[model samples]
Target: MHRGFFGLLALGLTFAVPAAAADNLKITGDETVVTIETDDGVVDITRQKTEAALIGGVLQPMVPVPGVTPVGELEVLDALKTKSAKVVDMRTLEWRTKSTIPGSIHIPYTEVAMRLNELGCSGSQGAWDCANADKMIAFCNGPACPQSPTAIKAMAREGYPPEKIFYYRGGMQDWVVLGLTVAEDMF
Candidate 1:
């Protein structure tokens, strides 16, 4: 092997570290460890075990966008119950047809920036005044999915306050895994 490859291995760069605030998203006693028998030996792989893994997609970092608060199931529920926040499902229509978090509004990532008015921002698409933008929680298929992250960045670029944005990185994968409420008729 090349010396650089050995150096990379020695640096222990196998997995990406999830950003902080992940504790709020973990379900009780969730086990992420996986055991596999390799040709050379037995391997125990831990981390990168979100439900997104089962569905087959690249595992995303716990924090997609810096300065955005990352939240979980409980936080999502509380926010919905209190009517203190708007939970947005940033997936495309096809994905959303399967299932979604209850009370979350559908706002495909492709159109979020143009739809800021629906979020309480005034003015037109290019000249938005988001001073009154609502506090929003954005999510998609799972941490592996980029829809919400894309929407989030667009919102931020359009002057949506990062403080008013919360990211539910676990998304539908974690929500379904936890057996929380799912909304099937959300078009």
Candidate 2:
């Protein structure tokens, strides 16, 4: 390998290190060891961990958006079968044109708050009348997607019923990954 590659590897990635909070970190090892107090417990960051942190950051997992339930493919499948739920797409215009969940309504994340009336979500005089719809599920790309979460939050802020709103976190990525049927967006 070229010497430049080694030099590039040695370049450290920056991470936001918060000051010691209510949690106390106990350091027992040498200068190389870094102890961080997490909710689980104090974890030691060794040389290996430091490298990993640079690549992946503090090793945190995907957390669901607050005030919304994270659902998977099977759950969405059941929802579709029940015919009581209304699955909405929160992706962009370009991405939505490629593919989307079959029978899902297209309401981009950016328009969620404004389009609530068009969805007839009980607040405005929309022709759709969401009152007849059981659960209004929203989804985007996948678990890492922020569109659906942001839309769901917008709905909540608009006083949409928490019980009626659901978040399908798996989204189109998981839907395609699991070989589920997809509908090409005609709109």
Candidate 3:
């Protein structure tokens, strides 16, 4: 029994290590940076790790809403590349003016629900009908920032379909640390 158990454990580790390596997003090596063209200009997106402060404000929950899917850099990038969903910057204009994901749109947490029509929903400010809302990926400052979470929760409460929402919890913090493309002038 013990020998069989040890054998299984070794096999599991063997597979696990390779899988982990394949999925590793760690920033290393001298040639790891990448670049992408944006509306503003060509920007370098790096996988080079930095010691800069990347997170601030109050931390938010992992899953902001029960049915909303949480995503990371790769997922967010794929969506932007494919144009499969709208990437929204939930931070206020002040925060957005500093820097933001290249292709994302602005919709402050305070105004998201009131502006549901922009996401394909209809009705009015108080009466939202979001049955036909578009697929959206929401993000803000960073893990500690509550803007995205606040916007996501409000969106859910306002009857926006949770299944259609994707939360990028790392927000701008992770985006910058990872050396991803950011648009400085969002106006």
Best by lDDT: 3
Best by TM-score: 1
Which portions of model 1 show Cα errors greater than 4 Å?
1-55
**TM-scores for the candidates:** 0.71, 0.60, 0.71
**Count of clashes, each model:** 0, 0, 2
Better of 1 and 2 by TM-score: 1
For model 1, residues 79-169, the per-residue Cα lDDT tens digits are: 9999899999999998888898878898999999899998889987778999998999999988667788888989889888888999998
* Clash count in backbone of candidate 3: 2
What lDDT does the true structure give each of the candidates? 0.79, 0.64, 0.80
Model 2 C-alpha lDDT per residue in residues 1-187, reported as the tens digit of each score: 6545335546753334434332322222223457788654666554332311112112111333455666677777777888667788888888788888887888898987777775556555233245543567788877546677778777767766666777776677678877899989636
Candidate 1, pairs of clashing residues: none
Candidate 2's displacement at residue 63, Å, is 6.8
In model 2, pairs of residues that clash are none
